[model samples]
Target: MRILIIHQYLWSHYKGKIYSELQKIVNTHKNDELLVLQTSLNEITRANLGPVDRSIHQYNYQVLVDDYYENIPNTTRAKKMLYWVRKFKPDVVNISGYYEPAMNTVLFYCRLVGIKVIISVDSTEEDKPNIWWKEAIKRFVVNRAQGFFCYGSKAAEYMLKFGAKPHQILLENNAVDNQKIASIYKEAYQTRETEKAKYGLRPFNFIYTGRLMAIKNVANLLIAFAKLKPQNWGLVILGDGAEGENLRKYVADEQLEGVTFIEGQAWYNVPKFMALGDVFVLPSYSEPWGLVVNEAMVGGMPVIVSNKCGSSHDLVKNGENGYTFNPYDTDELAAIMKKFVDDPDLIKSFGAVSQSIIKKYSPEQVAQEMYDGFKKVMYEHK
Candidate 1:
């Protein structure tokens, strides 16, 4: 079997790890082959994360454009993608998204050629408001696919609402490289004391790592932190974005001490910062799938994520691993944050559960699930 994946960009370190693992799995099979065609090297929105090192991408892949994804012309992307599809003659085509005109064109061509399509879906129904016309179009496009590789239950449920069958839902786990992150966290843990002193972090730090965008609700996190006003507890906001200056001003205006704002680090270097925090928090009002939560869980840090996040449904076990609160309710978020501050012991206990829960969402496991989905689509669906 030959599998071809059309991805928007080659910038995701998490996806690169999964693709590399999937490639290794494909190689083990005598006649199986896999190839990924990425539209561009990176997306303009992700430029703050810095250049993606090409050396880490170990899978068989071709970059269709050297520019950012948004800058790539649709016609050029469609032509290059079609050229690769025709040349490869793949048995299965997995499209990363449906919104792009180029991806839609490729999907149409694949359907017309009788080649099975497996849509890789990360969007949940709650990610955005549903307009009737847009939902209708989504239904039309979704029904054309033979299979789906969903990021989580929320994504699978969203696809089901759009007329995809349960059986067609193939791979459900969206993951990062757990072993790599855990290993990095372990090494960083060795120098934890030095790093903590270097960064001037407090004894107990609640860390949020990601772009400081409006949707991330970092201001709400600040408000929650202010409500506590604990001397020993710190709030670490890592990553720079459009709202960086505004958040800093708000923090200064409120005179919120023990709050540290660090610029974004490279993907590989993020876990090093993760070692400084006791618990991880993602208070996003809208997040499809928070892979940062996965990284935190792998690093054995309990997470306080918004219920709106897709990962909260799959990864968070409520009070077990960590609590999920409504992003809109600052009081609810504040109460949850106080849980860690009041009883410091809950951090270690909850973090232990986080590690155990995250074990199943490893790159190796997700790659095997994807390989199984490819086989099922190629054989059973036929």
Candidate 2:
């Protein structure tokens, strides 16, 4: 099946879950080109970091775009897309948005020409559009899409407020590349021990990989780490964001001597980091869905995420695979982290369970669900 995807903000450093998953499936399918018509903005959401004006494929580019419609906000981008449509003649048109200004109009026009749409949603309570206009973009445009794929049930709940039917919504998780990353870690560990030892991290380390933003509540993590620093379990902060300086100040003020904040590293280095961590924690105040949760699960570490995170609903099974703590309660995070480190038996059992649970979130499974939904949509709408 020929599929044309409309995902604005394609990054050079790392591709988003949908595009990466689709590419993997398309490669296997052989007949599919998966014509991707994406646009990206040169905007920065972080407070730090000077601009790097290289080609589209340089630096750890910010994947988040402030202008949902990518600044074009007019017919120009839509008109240009038609040119691609004529050449590709995609059987499926997956608009990676719903509430952006010109996005719905573009999808409606595609339908006028006979392409079926499978619009994916990026909605989250933490990242919802401003309450103004009563969320018209979602209520009017999203409800009518052929199919809606999202992170999970939390997204389905939000889409329902927008008048979308439950059946039309399929859960598409922001998952980790299980096979690729794990193999890299395995190879890296077999060759190098000095690299990890240089950072004061021993074999039994705990890691956190993500942006250092306010909502992420890495400060909460530092507090939790303070409770467990006596146990010899080192803490590593992986990604960088606006809250970096504030977090550093807080760490110093708290006198968290053992906690180490390593700025954003290469995305490919994730497995190696994950290998270092005996347990993983994401103490987000209100994360819609964290991709790092998937990484931790696949890497054989017992994960601890906030109940506020959307993915925690599916990913964490409490004592079975991992723990989901209330974000407001630092004590809960501390308890889980201590358990992960103190009891190796529990870690092994939970890690095994996490590995089994990760199968449901694979890219191939999600892509097939998307393809089947597209065919069903065509059968009904045609």
Candidate 3:
């Protein structure tokens, strides 16, 4: 099938778990005459932590599009997309996000051509949708697209409120490669054991992996860590961003000795580091569904994620598998960390529960669920 995948905020330097699976399919099907057009360089394009590999087409989408500042806020994006539609004449035009200036522009093109448009949004929050224009545009294009795909059930409900029909919203839960992780866990854990001894492993190591943007609440993490000086916990901040440098400076100024901040590592290396952690935490301001949560869970590390992260709503069993805390409340985050520190048996017990739950998150299984979503949308559209 000829597909035209459009993601305006898709940067070539960015590496996501979705990229690994999609690229495998793209590489296998490149001979099938597939075209994946992508656009990027949104708000947090700085601190590009992409790999420097020359051989791998890590960021190369099947097709490429540019978004300049001058072109934004103008109708030029709509005109360009219309031209692309006519020239490419694809069977499917899948869009990643329906937010920002790109949302209405893509909606207009999809309406004009009567072509299939599939939207995959993170989620909408009751506190703040951020992109209020997106809600209005979604209602306007209620039946314009084939269907809408949400990361979690809560997000699906929110999308329906924006005028997506009951049958139109599908759940494509974010997952990780459990089989791949299982294959390498034994070896990686052994390697990490030796590596940790050499690097001087600290007790109760708390690791956070993801973008260090404002939404991640890295500052809140620092505040919580500061409260745990007498405790055994040490914060290991992984991933890079604009807030990364500032955060490093803040750590030094605050004289945070227990914290060790490593620059962001590549996507493939993340799982290994997660294996070394005693506990993993993600205090996202409002993440649709952080895929890294599954990565950590598969790595057998208990996670303390914010309630805003869409995955936390489903992946976290609230004290059974892992803990959940409010992003805005550092005290709550600190308390969760303290629980893990105070009890070593909790790690072994909860870690077992976490890993058992991760078995179902295999890539093969997730791919089937995603394919089901695709078929459902296509059949309903017909």
Better candidate number, 1 or 3, judged by lDDT: 1
Where does candidate 2 have its weakest 10-residue lDDT segment? Answer: 56-65
What's the CA RMSD of model 2 in angstroms? Answer: 4.8
Tell me the whole-model lDDT of each prediction, alpha carbons only: 0.93, 0.70, 0.68
Best by lDDT: 1
lDDT of 1 by residue, 216-317 (tens): 999999999999999899999999899999999999999899999999998889999999999999999999999999999999999999999999999999
lDDT of 3 by residue, 215-332 (tens): 7899998999888774566778888876988898898898887787677766557767776677888998888788788878887778888998888887888888889888999999
Which residue pairs collide in model 3, if any? 8-39, 36-63, 215-285
Error of 3 at 193 (Å): 3.2
Q: Measured by TM-score, how close is model 1 to the native structure?
A: 0.99
Q: What does candidate 2's lDDT look like per residue over 1-382, in tens digits?
A: 7777766655422334445555666677677666666555433442223232234232122222344334554566666666666777878787767755556776877768877777777566555345757587557777567778787767777777777777777655655566766677677666446767777765566788888888888888888888877556678888898799998898888877767778776566767766766678888888777777877787766888888888888888998988888888888888888886677677778888888898788765776677667656756656
TM-score of each: 0.99, 0.83, 0.81
Off by over 4 Å in 3: 9-35, 40-47, 52-61, 66-84, 100-103, 126-134, 176-186, 249-254
Q: Sort all candidates by TM-score, best to worst.
A: 1, 2, 3
